[model samples]
Target: MVNRSQNVYIIAEAGVNHNGSLDLAKKLIDVAAEAGADAVKFQTFKADNLVRKNASKAEYQTRTTDASESQYAMIKKLELDEEDHQILIQHCDHRGIQFLSTPFDFDSVDLLVHKFNVKQLKISSGEITNAPLLLKAARSSKPIILSTGMSTLGEVEQALAVLAFGYTEPDSMPSIEAFHFAYCSVEGQQALRQNVVLLHCTTEYPAPFEDVNLRAMDTLATAFGLPVGFSDHTSGIAVPIAAVARGAVVIEKHFTLDRNLPGPDHKASLEPDELKDMVRSIRQVEAALGSPLKTPAPSELKNISVARKSLVAARTIREGEIFTTENLTVKRPGDGISPMYYWEWLGKTAEKNYEADEKVRR
Candidate 1:
């Protein structure tokens, strides 16, 4: 969804940290806007449509939330209705930040793209295999950010094939072969290039550092030949900043009004100040990743003569005198002949007289 001219897009993922409170959600919007995030993202889904009532909570979820509550029950409480979406969007508009949400089910996808008109759609890592949902998202024609986590390259490719099919939707019946055909077709590839951005992610809350595999971002770029970014779940701002350095075009990280707030994602999320630090650090890294050419930067050009060496007289010498090893040396103030000609200048007649520590001329 980002143009080539734009800096790395940073998304402050407020997620379910609002804990079913509209005031808290609006406050999160304010925090993200104040932090200078490109967008503030929330999770939008009816828990009934997403998970079975008896579905178990994930280990990380259980640790952060009440283990006694079923996954559906916990998420059911976090569900943001249509009115909630409108309120959050208006809040985001007032705060001057884009509003985004991850759609976990078919209706949620429709709600985000059709009703609310979000600029882009973010497909969760868990939905990478949910072909129906992926197809529905792709069919909407909105740009999609697909997260690859707890999955293999092959799985990511398969998900992409489904998306490709949805985007190019040939007249044939939907099937694995049709999806493969679409993936192999020129039209499907072109559609993907224009509308999809892949995100490298690790599917764990507070994911381990070793498991991050930031290099996988490169692999995703190479293998898929699409714009790639990162969905960070690690403990701090460092990894995401490093990801930007490594050429991630977008960075999405979870944030909360307060870490100690009783919610599933709060503990793994950055607090307000930490979120600000993260956005500032990411912008700094983006600026540092300036040009690919290996040459002196504009700021360092003036320092070259002062810092580099040039041929100079080691001791006093008369005009037309023979330049010798003992009389010639390399020194600073490189406006004179470069030290590379030290051997050539040796034993040659000096064009002009020079004094001790003076720059030698041809």
Candidate 2:
């Protein structure tokens, strides 16, 4: 979905780190672009649609924001209108970075896909079971990156079934049975292969390293035959870099101009400099991944003679003298008979006299 055909699609997620200021949001875009991210992402939603007035903030949100504030009140301050979305889209264009946003409601999805025309839709982990939203996203036909956190294999499969039904547009009405039928169909699987990318994520802010479960990422790739990526919520750059090394095809991590900035996600996000380091480190890991063949590298050829050992005369040996372990030994400068032939050379007559430490080039 993120054109993972090239390098891992690095998304510098600026999710609500802008503190609801359009200027701050623009600055975050600049930071992501400067850090060499493929895209900059923000959250798009109306507070009323996303949370109830009585809903309490999560434990981390309460710790980060006003403890007295309702979840709706906290998010209300951060809602970005359609006008703001357009400004961000324009800013991302100016900065030469792709724009992405997670849509929390159907209207937000329409605004992003139909109005601003973002290249893809980022579905957050909390929305994995939002079948209506997933179907709406697929009906739009823009590629989707669905995050799987706080979900099981069955739940993930169920979500994908909803997506498959929407992508295929089967004749029957949308229902659990229909979704399952579509998911089992060859045509539905093909549509999913072309339209969706799954991201393994830990939903908590500053997710615990132990909870990251990178092996589960491999499980995602095996269980679902689509490209898989990491939506990292860990404290630093290491987890994401390690994910790239372990075959993550895309990476999404949050960033903020300053971690001290008053926002729900800022404390867990990378500062400007750290974001750059993560991108640089991911690129380096990609280079290091290289080909899977177990062979010497191009740079290693010249060092073989210096580092590897070869058979050589341990002491002066006269011509016609029988070779033995005492008269022959392994030494460096491998431009001669390899040590692998030591057993064969034993008991064989020396073809010519050799000086001490001289390579036995037979």
Candidate 3:
């Protein structure tokens, strides 16, 4: 069970996939909670406040929707209002799961901090360069989780600098509340300061297997002295479970009601059933990662004799004959000399006659 006991905190990212429908959004929450996700996350943003009316969409965004529409226009249509927030929060309560959201604009962050009582503040990748947003988020003093996709080490370092020391006055440095990282590489962890958690991630939507580099998660923890995790963009549940095996403490993935839905994030997002499977798999893996001890476990101890081997006589040996490899071998029912004592038992005189397949005693 050494491999299965690690718990990966799974966050079901319901980013703008509700398609401006509160009913769909509530259903999404049900899906997340029912899937056993530790938390359900939504994107809190005002289209006009987050980006200029003329700002364009990312390439992936354009591919999913009409290329001519502005990113603001697309988001504005998909915006979740105050009423929606109230309902979603209450729905999360009813569903018995933590409610979380990533704020894209200053007002959205303030609203989440003051109105919803959100336990954790999530920083999306685009905001890594937005110093103003980072400062505001830091001031709220909530535990922060950062997405470092599309950022270089220097960019991450700069973001950390803004949070760690740059936000305070020139003469007074303030202590950050909490900092956590999620990325596609171990190199990203170098940009983090002390007390940070690094999560393995891939920037690509529905990230390719070759780009995962999951082993780098342990490398981050070992090299940077911090806890590690994963932010999966892979379309399936298998990668997240695999990541937990690599020692991920966090698991964040996009989730929506339907993959066939008409939204930029829907195609790569997990449907309700798939999200459930992902959570169940993660929990199962967590149960499996047990302790690291090599000794027999309490439960496994009873099977030791039945499963392990002990030294035994390969053939009948008359009393007073010296023990040799020709007459001694190893077999199960470990109640006699261990195979490790083979050398000591070799060339020794037997005190009594030994039958074939009988355990060898000192």
Candidate 4:
């Protein structure tokens, strides 16, 4: 399991950018490892199981891919067989990064768990209402990262219920009664909490910044009390970086070997150098977030005396002279009495003579 409390789990989503070539897929893994991403994710699904032969492409897919081709045809060409999965997993192990793939169907889910032995499962936005897939993933006993896009709070609740109760019906609505029954026991709730993480996403390619609605991540966190993250589809790295600052525990962004590649997701995906910059920036942000307690930092401790004010003698004073506002004022080099004690020292007598511009002693 990923340590959500520390660094954000960064996923370089290399979704179908390989264009059916195992060599290209390995290259994507290499890019993700070199870029310092925690994992490289791909999509796992048989084209026949994923889409109908006559199903249309999404608007963004139509713009990026061949308009005349059916969605099924477009997806069929990108399918990676069983041997391809093994090769990629070996490559990921050699490259020193976790291998992850979003399973689009029940068979794909089984393949990921039984064959690849994935530690966690990532569900795409389109599967938010996929009840059978949800139950299957939950039954696998691996943690899940679920993306919510083009979905309402109620739909998300239904999906969670499916995971919790092992629901078999795909179209049934989730209710409070169902939730209560599923979690009536302590172990059930604990199991649910341990097995789930939610992700907020905008289901568009190169999603508009206005549509990103990053605040929804916090909403999901508050609502579910589970770790929340962002599946960013925006054109730049700024949004994901900001998501980290806003308490995102994970960040999933699409990436490609080259943006000019002919594929549905290539245009919106980050190139290699940009991926590195995003990881670097996220680490910098994590370092800068630091502790919640407001105290003097080690680096700033030395500057306190140089920058803060202290009560000092405004003019020369002889021994036993009465300290007054005219003889004492605030100045820098706070090695003596702090100016906060000014009023307390105002009518007192000086223990000894003091030169002008000298810090006053207690």
Candidate 2 lDDT over 196-305, as tens digits, reads: 99999999988999999999999999998989999999999999999999999999999999988887888999999999999999999999999999999999999999
lDDT of 3: 0.78
Q: What is the C-alpha lDDT of each candidate?
A: 0.92, 0.92, 0.78, 0.89
Provide the lDDT at 191 for model 2: 91
Name the better of 1 and 3 by lDDT: 1
The alpha-carbon deviation from the true structure for residue 111 of candidate 3, after best TM-score superposition, in angstroms, is: 0.3
Count residue pairs with overlapping backbones in model 3.
Answer: 11
Q: Could you tell me how far off, in angstroms, the CA of residue 356 lies in candidate 1 after the best superposition?
A: 1.3
Residue-pair clashes per candidate, as listed? 0, 0, 11, 0
Q: Stretches of candidate 1 above 4 Å error?
A: 170-172
lDDT of 4 by residue, 1-362 (tens): 56766789999999899999999999999999999999999899999899999999999999999999999999999998889999999999999999999999988999999988999999999998877787788878788999999989878877787777652332445555655567445555577687788889999999999999999988888887789989999998999999999998899999998999999999999999999999999999988999999999999999998998999899998889999989999998888788889999988988998999987886
Score candidate 4 by lDDT: 0.89
TM-score of each: 0.97, 0.98, 0.86, 0.94
Candidate 3 Cα errors over 4 Å, as ranges: 1-6, 166-200, 215-226
Provide the global lDDT of candidate 2 against the true structure: 0.92
Q: Candidate 1, which ten residues in sequence have the lowest lDDT sum?
A: 1-10
